[model samples]
Target: KTPVATLALAAETLENKHIVEKPDKLATYAGIVKYQSDHLSKQIEKLLRFAHTESGRLHLAKTTVDMHELIRESITHLMPLIQQKNATLQLNLNAAKSCMLADRDYMIIMITNLIENAIKYSKEPVIIITTINTPEHFILSITDNGIGIEKRHIKKLFRKFYRIRNNEEYVAKGFGIGLTIVRKIVSAHTGKIYVESVPAKGSTFTVELPGLK
Candidate 1:
């Protein structure tokens, strides 16, 4: 069932008088209601942003953003998903110059999307996030021990609403717009994104942006 349907069913159960008599069942349904509501809200918000991106009306409120701090915050925000997946996050923030001019909110969304993708697709998620500051560029790389993409699919991964069809029994639930938004955000900041993967091994996504002035 979709999130909306699940939320409706959960809400109806919560309103049942008999549910109040079973505290454990009540709690479980209540949790479902909350989780589904959150999931629906997030999906709606992503769709709205995608519409804005498509219309070319997406605006960025530029500011000085600390990449390390933003990365840490993104990890914190996704801690629940990480723990649920038994994921291990290794942060290698080696960049001496960690600050850059970018839209803070968009950066947060982009970083969160990347990390969340890693966690969702991997069986045993071990994500390594690394940052490097070069003389002319700031590079952020996220590596995941996940079901790696094929070379043919990698090029199309950022296309709007494009999803890879695989034979796996379990597939991640998404509208397939997350990476599209990520790529748009990176492009708005005049950055370049790349991916490297070998089938059955893993994948690495790297975003390169202009160094701090």
Candidate 2:
């Protein structure tokens, strides 16, 4: 049977068996179902986005976007996770007044993934996000005091489904598709991603794109 059919049957079975009869049990089961549903939704969205990007169907509204404001907005959306981890979120947005010609949605997705990943693997409780404008390029950097990746894993980080096999101590909740999506989005905007890391020292991700006057 198809995956959706299988899931439907499982849900029906769970309901019919009355395994969630107690109020608390039912609530717990509901939470699990919701979490799975949300996870599936994100995966589907990512796949659709990837398909559109590959087919060149993704729409881009090339307008001037304030880099500093965009970064602050993205961090605000991720504030709960940062707070939950007791991690400090610092924004050294020197380029806040600088504008870039790009799609707002794509930039948001790129920044969101970078910040989220920083919060996820970080053990140092601090994250620094900064934006800089070079003579020819705009640079967005997210640095975290996380578990830090090894050199070998750096090359594969952008590959679809690629994940580092760290011990459970460093494992985060994900299907390992976020970076792949981020890479695609960055490339769609004619940008490149760079990484610098030392195991246990943390990692830094820098996105470089052509700057607009």
Number of the predicted model whose TM-score against the real structure is largest: 1
Steric overlap count per candidate: 0, 1
* Candidate 1 global TM-score: 0.89
The parts of candidate 1 lying over 4 Å away from their true place are: 8-29
TM-score of 2: 0.78
Q: Each model's C-alpha lDDT?
A: 0.88, 0.79
Q: Each candidate's TM vs. the true structure?
A: 0.89, 0.78
The CA lDDT at 152 in model 2 is: 89
User: In model 1, what lDDT does residue 53 have?
Assistant: 89
Where model 2 places Cα greater than 4 Å from the true spot, the runs are: 1-43, 54-58
After the best TM-score superposition of candidate 1, give how far the Cα of residue 108 lies from its true spot, in angstroms. 0.6
After best superposition, candidate 1 residue 104: deviation in angstroms? 0.6
Q: Candidate 2 on 34-107: residue-level lDDT in tens? A: 54565466558777787777676557788888777788888777665666578898778776336889998888
